[model samples]
Target chain A: MNTTTVDREDLRTLVAETLDLDVAEVTDTADFVNELDVDSLMALEVMVVLERRYAVKLDEKRLAEITSLENAHRLLTEALEKKG
Target chain B: MQTTMASGASAEALAVVAMVREVQDHRGPEIPLLLLNCLERLTGAGEADVVIRRPRGRRPTAQLDGRTIYLSVSHSAQMAAATASYRPAGIDIERVREVRNVDGVRAHITGFLPRHADATREPDAHAEVLRAWTRYEATVKALGVGRALVPSEFAGNAEPDITFRGLNLPLNLNTATLHTHRRNQHDSYLLSVAARPTSNVVIHHDSDLGYTPANHERHTS
Candidate 1:
């Protein structure tokens, strides 16, 4: 399995593509809801993708605390770090 | 007051007590109160900082320390969904009887459902719908975004299995585990609990003081 470092921009692009939203709408500070209009279902979808992409598990309670592109990026990074 | 159990008892072996009060049946904020009571008993803290959301126009409330604990509540069936997480959590219990325009919802939130549309065409279509909806709901609650996130933006490729006519919806996450129970025979209400990856989970029935008679005796003795 390739353990290459996954970049934040890559996650941003993936999220944008998966959700079919404009990439320009997503920013480090953009709220998943306010900016991209992500709902509960969409959030879970992103979660599933992250787990599959990174091969990491996210605690639901911890996932609840994430609210933005930046938050997701940070979490994915932490999960990757733990892997290393 | 520490309730002493039998010597050599491990904390994990100790039964977590839960209190269930059907205050308003389907109307009151009984679940939150039950959770608060359980937390109070479990933690032995008279009152700690807590936040609760209820269905409808109820506002979420919190109290620092008091016999009559304050709870902020709202009425959103969406809030009751459960997701696998590191913490012991609660989910919503509602039986959805119909599918309201899946095509429209799909257009908006395609990522939440499975890729195989045939899976949704079984005799248990209603159950599948509820299962999918609840899984999404539970995930959102676990994530703490509640209804703040739109239904359209959830995205993922893996599809979880739906078993028992919607009794189970696969979470498809590496870290969390999903367990569900159907309380009534008609399957009118579904309760799902999600927690971190653990070998075994003890489901405490609320009315039984969160203990089985066997475990209670084991602890009391």
Candidate 2:
């Protein structure tokens, strides 16, 4: 199986599409709750999107740390590596 | 007369009177934070900050100044509310709107219903479904399980010990007795409050507490 590397753009696109914001607006430094105006449901949706996109299951508690694009990319990469 | 009533009411009784304020001016996503701020001021929890514990795939619990205070927040369309009390409580408010197709939503909730569940079919099934959804949400909320609890878990003996009441929040000051009436659709939205060990749930409107509604709109996220 080919290893698909999760990149920053992939995480940014997912966040932008989940929140219906412009892709340009989802800066790597932006906070999910403070910048993207995400409540708990939206946050969960972001996780769900990531899970489906990567076909990898993630513990919800860990998603708490994926509050920014930078964080999301790092976490998703780690999860993918473990899956591989 | 004032002193008599004040003396008669216990601290817990006073806490039973939860505040349900509408901070519609704030954007939808920002309402929860505003509600916490409002709750802190109302409880006189000075210098106490709001904290939330987010469990993945579940609703988070709101804490005030490190103390566990029962809080339920809901927002739909343009309106938002924050319900705060000393006891375990849950509040839900939904915007009443026409749904062209409720079959999918109903199917999702069907497993939660008992075998002998009524309302198998009706003219107002859509509206009834919305009401039921709110009650279920409020009940789970009061149970402190939030969405993490499944409908099947609510089956039989696993049911939560909760009672719901409906209040008509007036455009002005008003007082109400808790658990007096089963929740009914109010205005354009459905409001429900669920609490364990049902008590006289009184709604203390902002004006009743000398909290002008304008104060709610003053804060911005």
Candidate 3:
């Protein structure tokens, strides 16, 4: 388990609330666009929120490649860890 | 202003814009001609370089210049929301007349509607169907691909919130953005705009361009 500055659990909750998805269904491998069916506009909204919460600027191209819950977790963990 | 012929890559790459105005049920061919004329004036392109696709009877028509200037005109008011991005990019507007139950609709067409869309207030059945249809059409238009690709191919994919399956589309095509704008006129209309990412988008009222009020209606219910 990667303990980073950004809490994975919190991220999951945010995703669920923002996208109106079942929190339990969000898995590490669940792709936001493919598995969760989150639209691009919503995705942008998520990015905006994440930036404000984490104080990090994610690259647009990089954000586009993140598909599953696991990918998001890994990216967030890595980013937060680097910030520390 | 007299039409002047200029020679250069900038002039050659210019996009030919077109418009069609239906006033008092007087649908004249001149609307499209004037639109093309305006495009010619805007881009300084000659008729030989422009490609016009006008469908017979009642259908959508598109004018294109290698994905640079793609213009699709539809008299249907339902199409207004989809055309808000027309100034700098291509737009496709559509209106739905029916939709199935939300649960069933998502079960079958989840790929088309993003999760956020599901969370948003469910629009009328027809409106929901129209939104998805216009988004798909706008994506195709932005890619400069005709209706050759199977709609099912775009059914299941995941990446960005907005995804375009360019499986067989030309290599030059990249990304497409979908936006919906509601117009309140004689009835409600939705417009969708699709264009290359490099292009800028500008939305203006018909009145702003000196178009007679009788031709363009207010965007309100």
Best by lDDT: 2
Q: Which pairs in model 2 have colliding backbones?
A: B178-B200, B178-B201
Question: Please, what are the lDDT tens digits per residue for candidate 2 over residues B53-137?
Answer: 5566455555765666666666644445456666666666554454323453443344323233332222365654454455556
DockQ of 1: 0.04
Q: lDDT scores for all predictions? A: 0.43, 0.51, 0.43
The superposed Cα distance between candidate 1 and the true structure at residue A68, in angstroms, equals 28
lDDT of 3 by residue, B69-182 (tens): 445443342122222122334444333333323333333334444344223222465555444544555565555454433334566533123444544221111112122233
lDDT of 3 by residue, A1-84 (tens): 533666778888877776677889887677776556554434544654665567775554455445666666667667777766
In model 1 chain A, where is the ten-residue run with the lowest total lDDT?
A33-42
The candidates, ranked best first by TM-score, are 2, 3, 1
lDDT for each residue of candidate 2 in A2-83, tens digit (9 for 90 to 100): 5558767867887898777899989998887766765443455576677777888666556457688888888887788888
Q: What is the C-alpha DockQ of each candidate? A: 0.04, 0.06, 0.02
CA error at residue B88 for candidate 1, angstroms? 7.8
Best by TM-score: 2
Chain B, per-candidate TM-score: 0.47, 0.56, 0.51
Query: Tens digits of per-residue lDDT for model 1 on B1-221?
Result: 12222233234423223222223332345555555665455445543464444445232333334322222111123222211112333243334344443343344444545466443322355444444565555444434455555444465433432222234332221111122232532223333322222212233333322221111111123
